[model samples]
Target: MPRYKLTIEYDGTPYAGWQRQAGLPSVQGVVETAIARFCSAEVTITTAGRTDAGVHASAQTVHVDLERDWPADKVRDALNAHLSQAGEAVSVLTAERVAQDFDARFSALRRHYLYRILNRRSPAALDARRVWWVPRPLDAEKMHEAAQRLIGYHDFTTFRATQCQAKSPLRSLDVLDVTRHGEMIEIRASARSFLHNQIRSFAGSLAEVGFGRWTADDLQAALEARDRARCGMVAPPYGLYLIGVDYA
Candidate 1:
């Protein structure tokens, strides 16, 4: 068997998510279907991350093994052609033969996520589904300042999902920065692995600081409390994107 690695990009608006579920449309399901069409065999693909419903990915990585040896370029082109024929929004950006030991998820060193907020008096028109429309004036600088409290190793219990299956709440968040580009406020988060809704929880809590409702001390307090009840709004999935994954 030959193993191949793939870099993928997708518009996640129409899919249930990156993971396949019975009778549900998913990025994985569509890509697997495309592969089956091109190769007439079932192959299990492993992804670096399982993005939630409505979340997008720009450089998602995955690996798969196939029965027949195929050129990397042919694999990319054939799968893409099949996906296009079916009108699926997923795309295989690159494909290369990799060693069998390269497990996409386990081998990932870090994952980067971007959350976008539209800070204006009116709703987003062009990038409606791509950004979170916040019709109030936001202080991106304050959000950045408050986000610093979340950097480094900590128990992110307040920012994690109640149903998160991770054994521990401790996660080393390498980066959490907020910046503004005109009317758009961007929040970037990087970590080895993230708890469910972790970034979204941060976004929601930080937005309070941006809106003058919470102080930097309050953000710190939330973290130290280590209670889910202290967490604020969870940003919507559409505003979140798995920008890239790193391996080392």
Candidate 2:
């Protein structure tokens, strides 16, 4: 068997999510179906992140195994062509042959996510599907100050979804920053792995700080209590993006 690594980018507005669902269209199902068409065989594709619905991916990575060898470029082109024909909301940016041992999910070292908030009274028109439109101004500096309290290894039960399947809530957050560029307020978070809905929950809570509804000490207490009910609201899925993944 031969293994191939694919770099993928997708506008996730129309799919259920990255994982394959029985009745719902998904990024993984679309890409796997395209690969099967190109290889003329059954193929299973595994991704580095299982992003939720309405969340975009700028540089998502996946690995697939085929029964026979095919040129990397041909694999990329054929998959893209099939995806276009299927009217799926994904594109294969590139594909390359790799060692058989290269597992996309297990080999990942770090994953970075960005959450975007459109700060204005009017709703977005051009990039509405890619951003969250908040009708009020957000104090990015205050959000940043509160986010600093969340860095380092800690139990993040307060920020995780109740249905999360992670064995543990202990994760070392390598980076957490809030910044503003023009009318967009962006939150960047990086870690080895994230619990289900962790980023969205964090964003929802931090937004309160930006709006003066919460304070830095409130965030500290939430983390200290390790209680889910202590955290702020969970932001909508549209604002989240899997920006990058690093491998060792």
RMSD of each: 0.8, 0.8
Per-candidate clashes come to: 0, 0
lDDT, candidates in the order shown: 0.93, 0.93
Q: Which residue segments of model 1 deviate by more than 4 Å?
A: none
Candidate 1's residue-wise lDDT over 116-227, tens digit each?
A: 9999999989997899999988899999999999999999999999999899999999999999999999999999999999999999999999999999999999999999
Models 1 onward score TM values of: 0.98, 0.98
> Candidate 2: lDDT over CA atoms?
0.93
Q: Which ten residues in a row have the lowest lDDT in candidate 1?
A: 35-44
Query: What tens-digit string does per-residue lDDT give for candidate 2 at 1-248?
Result: 88999999999899999999999999999998888888788788989999999999999999999888989998899999999998887889989999988988999999999999999899999978999899888999999999999999999999999999999999999999999998999999999999999999999999999999989999899989999999898999999999888987
| Total backbone clashes of candidate 2, pairs 3 or more residues apart or in separate chains | 0
Q: What lDDT score goes with residue 191 in model 2?
A: 96
**Against the correct fold, how does model 1 do in TM-score?**
0.98
